[model samples]
Target: MTSHPTVGHVHLRVADLDRAIAFYRDILGFDVTQQSATAAFLGAGGYHHHIGLNTWDSLNASPPPAGHTGLYHSAFLYPDRASLGTVLCRVAAAGITLDGAADHGVSEAVYLRDPDGNGVELYRDKPQAEWPRNPDGKLAMINARLDVQAIMDEAP
Candidate 1:
């Protein structure tokens, strides 16, 4: 296989395109790069699009029923802890409640649902030098409650 490839984009089927746009654009701060009556594309650092939203097939449709096999979640990686914390503050200000937050040894993540009930994860990875490893040089990851308040304190 070739070298590892980065995730390109995530497309979601939303019920209300407008509401979904509000979440990704206003709340999460992605730029609305393109939009149509039933579809939209959003980007962060000026790439074409990092996220795409569409109501073509799912317009007004209810979220997928629970207890079914579907996407676990889409993870958005921030550049640093402070940047991640800044978004956490935005999430709180918008009254979007998080489902959970955790420190996974090599990363810190916050989980929540989108307007259409699609799971989302906002996170930042620790430097590789700080990653936990066993004596044999294997990864040693842990799931622990994250200090959300402390993280928020670093918000810009």
Candidate 2:
């Protein structure tokens, strides 16, 4: 049995395929690897597909209501601080309002909702050597304010 398995991708049921594609491709900078009338596959850096969007069961459907048990969010990891900041700038330029931003000890993250009201998190992990640890050597993650301005300043 393998103890290390990485998350391969996320498949989402969206209301509009084209609109969702615009958000993930245009705003978030993923390339449209493949698409159909009701589905699209997007990826970064030429990977097959990191995100799969489909209108199969949710065409023109409303987003899930609040206080329900469903997908909380989908997190996308950036390679570095500057890359993360660059994406944040793109997000802002697209007029997308962030839900929040935080420094989670081991990573810095910004949360926002997608075009279909699906929660999305964009983040970058700090080096393992920089992750916080308790005196007893246990992980000590913290949710603190992220200096978004400082991060954005690092963008190319």
Candidate 3:
């Protein structure tokens, strides 16, 4: 594997294809590249896909029970704080309640669940020079309350 390889995409099993599409497309603003009765591929900036939603084996299936080992969340990184805030506003307008919001020293993030109950995180990273570091130069990440209103103020 290449040392600099990046995560290409995330594929999720969803109970309803259309509902998932509405959330990812209408709410989060990803463009739908391709879709079928059982699956859909969505992307940003015209890449092939950053997210894949499917109902092949999971059609109408319920989300996994709590405490079971499974995916924690799939995070989407916005290009900047304004972009992140813009999407956060859309989520709020759509009546989606955020699970949490935090400043993690290097980034600000908002957490929520998709229509199928899959965890999702939307965030924007601060510049490398702004990341917190310990005296030894190691990262010193902290979870602190993020002023979501401040971010919204920066949105277009």
Candidate 4:
């Protein structure tokens, strides 16, 4: 069996396909690789698609109520801190408000909601050697504050 398979794509049901496209394409800098009247495929660095947005059944539908069982968030990993910071700048320029930012020992992440209210996490992982571990060598992930301003300052 193949070990350590990577997640290749995430397909989302959005309320307004155009609005979702604006957020993912215009704001987040993904390329619109394909699109239909009610669907879109977005990718970065060009490999088919990383995210698919469709409104087949969710057209004009409302977001799920709080305290419901569903996707908590879909995380998009960046290659480095500078890349993540560039995204932060784009997000700010788009006037989208962030839910929060955090340092999770091995990663720095910023959280926000999409136009359809789905949670999105933008993050960059630290080097494997920098990961925190307990005395027994188990990973010790911590939820700590991230200095977002400092991160933004590193944007290219």
Q: List the residue pairs that clash in candidate 2.
A: none
Candidate 4 lDDT by residue in tens digits, 1-156? 878978999999999999999999887778999999999999999789999999999999999999999999999988999899999999998888999999999999999999999999999999999999999999999999999989989998
How well is each residue in 30-147 modelled by candidate 2, as lDDT tens digits?
9999999989999999899999999999999999999999999999999998998898899989989999999999999999999999999999999999999999999999999999
**Root mean square deviation (Cα) for candidate 1:** 1.2
How far off is model 4, as Cα RMSD? 1.1
lDDT of 3: 0.95
Candidate 2 Cα deviation (angstroms), residue 102? 0.4
Pairs with backbone N, CA or C atoms under 3 Å apart (clashes), candidate 1: none
Query: In candidate 1, what are the lDDT values of residues 1-156, reduced to their tens digit?
Result: 679878899999999999999999887779999999999999999999999999989999999999998888999989998998888999999999999999999999999999999999999999999999999999999999999989889988
Q: Of models 1 and 3, which has the larger TM-score?
A: 3
Give the better candidate number (1 or 4) by lDDT.
4
lDDT of 4 at 27: 76
Clashing pairs in 4: none
Error of 3 at 128 (Å): 0.7
Residue 79 deviation, candidate 2, in Å?
A: 0.6
User: Which residue pairs come into collision in candidate 3?
Assistant: none
The alpha-carbon deviation from the true structure for residue 65 of candidate 1, after best TM-score superposition, in angstroms, is 1.0
